[model samples]
Target: MVVDTEPRMLKHQVVRKSLDSLLEGMSPGDPFPSERDLADAHDVSRETLRQAIRELLVAGRIERRGRTTVVAAPKVVLPLAIGSYTEAAREKGMSATRILVGWSTYSADAELAELLHIDTGAPVVQLERVFTTDDTRVGLETTRIPADRIPGLIETFDYRTSLYAELRTRGIIFGPVVDTIETVLPDAREAALLTVDTRTPMFLLNRTSYDDQGVPIEQRRSLYRGDRMTFTAVMGA
Candidate 1:
């Protein structure tokens, strides 16, 4: 809702920011002050406070909890495997927002060229991103796409969309992935970006996606929050 800057606008801004913080799940149901207390703190009239609360209720951002109120939304649980990040996120009704921190062509180092089965110094597009769940940052990924094969990648869609789908439309495929993961200590940048302090660790998943002809098309490294994610892998006897 585009709220106009009316005479009673400060209270609305306070409510909006507070509701957004609530949806971030910082507090479950223990945060919203009472009607009278909020009115006192914000220096607004009780009627004004009531109106702001009503707006939040209409927006579905909060609900009554016991005698008080609590945030209404929960983080989504997106299942991952076999499909692309965008695919898994979309399947679970997430918006799949991406912040493209890095996007450029690099000459593949020896290790990278070997992984993609290309000559050393072949052009590769590297993309680093943080993906969010409900506008809250949840995961970080650094991916490399071999350039000659994916030709003109930047000219096409926005960097944040489903690259796998785009590639399929161009008759390219990364058939299935072989992945491994380990619990890792977060570097400073990763910790800051993922909203985890140094004391908290992340699960680092390194994946190599291959084509039907056994060619590697993309290699990705992702760091996911340890508290928010669980992995379920089927086993073969």
Candidate 2:
């Protein structure tokens, strides 16, 4: 015997349609009505309304800021390419800004040496910066490069601008880069820098770049706010 599934499906569809209609009339960062009020207006149970809201949260249409839920800005689509983050934001019609937090030169530890293909105890330059679009903090990036590779880079180059451009001028163009992406919860320091709660999820991107001669040039670690960024990849057979 076939079971009747139309009623349950109809409830879900109706709840989704109602929420979608509500969203169409709301602007980004606008407060959403209370669940009880929305349920009453949609003539659906509270559970049904909650399920619809959960779907919207997963779709990045809404977010919880502090204690209230509000409409979310469109997720910035980050392409998987070897390019400057500033250039990427410009392509999306957004102005990108970089704030240098600090920089220093240090002796490479074993792990840093392995990542940059340098000798342990050799000098390396470490630079930290926060990336923003307009006034919204989007990401935090830390990069390490062998000091010997780019002499005077720490003193001569402006950390607020694109490092790739400066490296290009010095004939250190990138040939290939390997990227690994993972989801992580921010630590207290990271949360403070990104202006998000420690419990908020983030995307951790670790990348290593090599020069034309297969020499590792730089290793970068970037943490992007999950609520503000989405990654897209193109795959082929």
Candidate 3:
């Protein structure tokens, strides 16, 4: 005789494990099995199978494609350090590119002045760009820098080049940076720009980078697709 004292796995949990295996062998963009078909194959009710599918959806292993579900591409992992987004994508074996969407000069408001350690009404250049990885839209970033700091930046710098690299060419050396991250819902404009559902959660990151002399270099705000982007950090005691 054998004894089994452990609690049995829930039906949905069991189904989820099986589905994970199926996803492992599936290619990105491949259609996921329909709910009815999955239920029949797993010998479970549609509602039960749905619970399992929902988990995968939230985990970014699958995504909604019109009326069907499809396997999703792997998420891009960003390190919690001062570096280039393109470099991070390359480390993950993904191609990274950016498009300049908005660029202009504006006077710093009270909040922006405080963050940039400049007087209110100081002129600053703002650059808005969208980033893509492996042909998938991944994030939008807006960077503001004091206009006087990077003279001729608007006319001389190439938007397609790395912003950090451009700064280096202008004799700007990066120092320590402060970063803040949060989960948020994008507004209509942002959702449309990213081609994501308004209800989809996003990761918002605000960063202020300093120059080697401890002067503020740039203030940047970035919104990353929750399903397509992830962040990693190294901690020491």
Q: Write one digit per residue (lDDT tens) for candidate 2, span 1-237.
A: 998776566575678777888899899989988889988998889998888887776567887776788998888887877878877888889988898889989999999899898889999999999999866788999999999999998789887788999999998868989999999989999999987778667899999999988999999999998878888888789
Quick one: RMSD of model 2?
Answer: 3.6
For candidate 2, what is the lDDT? 0.87
Cα lDDT computed for each candidate against the true fold: 0.74, 0.87, 0.90
What tens digits encode model 1's per-residue C-alpha lDDT throughout 168-217? 89887557788898988788999788765554446799998998899898
Candidate 3's C-alpha runs over 4 A off are 1-15, 39-51
> What is the C-alpha lDDT profile of model 3 across 76-119, one tens digit per residue?
88897887897778787888888888899999999999999999
**Residue 208 error, candidate 3, Å:** 0.6
| Sliding window of 10 residues with minimal summed lDDT for model 1 | 57-66
Clashes of each: 0, 0, 0
Q: Which model, 1 or 2, shows the larger TM-score?
A: 2
Q: Pick the candidate with the highest lDDT.
A: 3
Q: For model 3, give the 10-residue run with minimal summed lDDT.
A: 192-201
User: RMSDs, each prediction?
Assistant: 13.9, 3.6, 3.7
Is candidate 2 or 3 superior in lDDT? 3
